[model samples]
Target: MPLPTGPVIGIMMDNLKKRKSVFPISGRKAVKWSQKLEIPVGGETVLYTGSMYQLLPYMIAAVNRMGKMEDSFLGQYVGLGRFFNKMFNVSSIMFRPKRADHKRFRRIIRDIARLLQQAGVDFGYLYKKELYAGALAFDLGVDETFVAHAQRLSNLFKAQGVRSLITIDPHTTNVLRSVYPTIIDGFDIEVKSYLEVLAENDTLRPINKVEGEITIHDSCVYARYEDVVEQPRQLLRRAGYTVKEPKNNRNLTHCCGGPIESLFPSMAHQIGGKRVQQLKDAQGKGVATMCPICMATLQQAANGDLEIDDIASFLAKAFCPPGANDKSAEEKRSQP
Candidate 1:
């Protein structure tokens, strides 16, 4: 079904008007925690927050809007005119939006940090300084807002002396690595996905091990656009899972139906369901996703029939080991 055009545009405009994001709460909390710990933020290496943590909220709001619309006059009128080309597009059942699994996003952030620590790649997170990368704005064809956001983000990074950025997700990575350069003159900043950065340091070893056959879902933007197909797989293999390839893998990978989710949820679901079935056809023990949007979209489409995990989470579990926790050895050992 075509997405509810009116509502999607409204949400985008709302996001622009807010000048932040509809889902800044989580990242704001993370920033607060970093401040409490006196963690020095913003230097040569900055941890890019982007919209990975906020993706769930966008999905939640969109799904919620669809729900509220179902019982309104629009739904009744749309049904009455069933003969129209847009008929049968009145239901939000396609997206059984869960409680917006934010805990998972937090875990993904921590996992990235731990992985970086193991790789001996020191970085600082901006926390409060981090801004949404405006990937959604770019994707929705809202160029004016996106360019303005990009300029502001560039200025923020430049002021912070951030020479390099470790992006958390493909969308951010693509926006920073590919899109920004085209629009923002002198966009001299270096952007690397956490996967690319981690992959560069071969000495990084997993302190723990996990056993499973994981089927990988490649992010369309990462794979096709940024050529980030190998870094994730390399990390997963290093984590000790037997990597299984679905028929549509690598550059030929199928989308999890996320890119257009905001504008076309029902069609997104149909596409997502088909991709889920494709992953199931591989019959791997679980499905591993490298993008937050992919994880959220597929998890919903799977409806608990399949286990989905962010690749970073799986790698963190493999490398960090149980009992290691997230603590400095000095602090842990000094505690009675």
Candidate 2:
């Protein structure tokens, strides 16, 4: 028996309301760390959207959940979910071992900072004052909460004297760039992806060469919707790595199985696996992903067969090579 998408969506909504994340336990820990570091947990962006576009996954899931779904794992998971929901009034939506990890979270943040430093970009963190962009809520069709949250974020930026934002992920980049201006009146905040900022400037030269082909996985939000297709590739090329394209690349790229992961874990895995296979077929030793969700999904799908990293990490290694002196890296940044 296939579980209806409505129920799955309902369950996710319930979980989001209570757990505040599809990956509840991990989300909570990420949130705690975000507070501790004074940086926003990049994934918490869902708590702030009213866009129907963001709800398309649910609509598609609803249609798919109607019959025997394609993936056996998802079918079994859904079956277990129905049993729990019916018997105990408990939903199996909040799965454990969430994609978000505290260590990785910190690493991503630091990687971006290092990437910027290597690029000769002078930037400062809002530190304890940064708020989650509420991307997930916006994606899940919880517009009212998203709007309120957006207003709060806007106010925070103003209060903190933030003139510009350098976002790490596509989700945060999309919400802050495409969504914020429309909802928040008189929105004057300048939002740019860190990749975009680096690409626009030529000051960051790659001193260390990274050898071999690195497959690039474009985030849907980053590529098609936001048209951030070239920035990462430009950075990658500058870093001295040959960029390879899979069957699906750029605007036509396949989903990493992330957007639908929370609602259909097995299906998400299936999609991610297929995409990873496609990248592998391209014969790249490693894959480079720009989005946090894409990085997580593709890495899960790779299962150790291929190396995967966020583009920031790739750039960090290229500019700040492992064996290089930290003082030299800093001195390079300080040069005219």
Clashes of each: 0, 16
What lDDT tens digits, residue by residue, belong to model 2 across residues 261-307? Answer: 65666677789899989999988868898876787667767776778
**Segments of candidate 1 deviating more than 4 angstroms:** 1-7, 22-27, 30-39, 67-100, 323-336
- Candidate 2's C-alpha runs over 4 A off are 1-100, 321-336
10 residues in a row with least lDDT, candidate 2: 44-53
Q: lDDT, candidate 2, residue 105?
A: 42
Q: Candidate 1, after superposition: displacement of residue 222 in Å?
A: 0.7
RMSD list, candidates in order: 7.9, 8.7
125-225 in candidate 1: lDDT tens per residue?
A: 77777878888778877788788888998999888889999998988999999999999999988999999998888878877768889999999999999
Whole-model lDDT per candidate = 0.73, 0.65
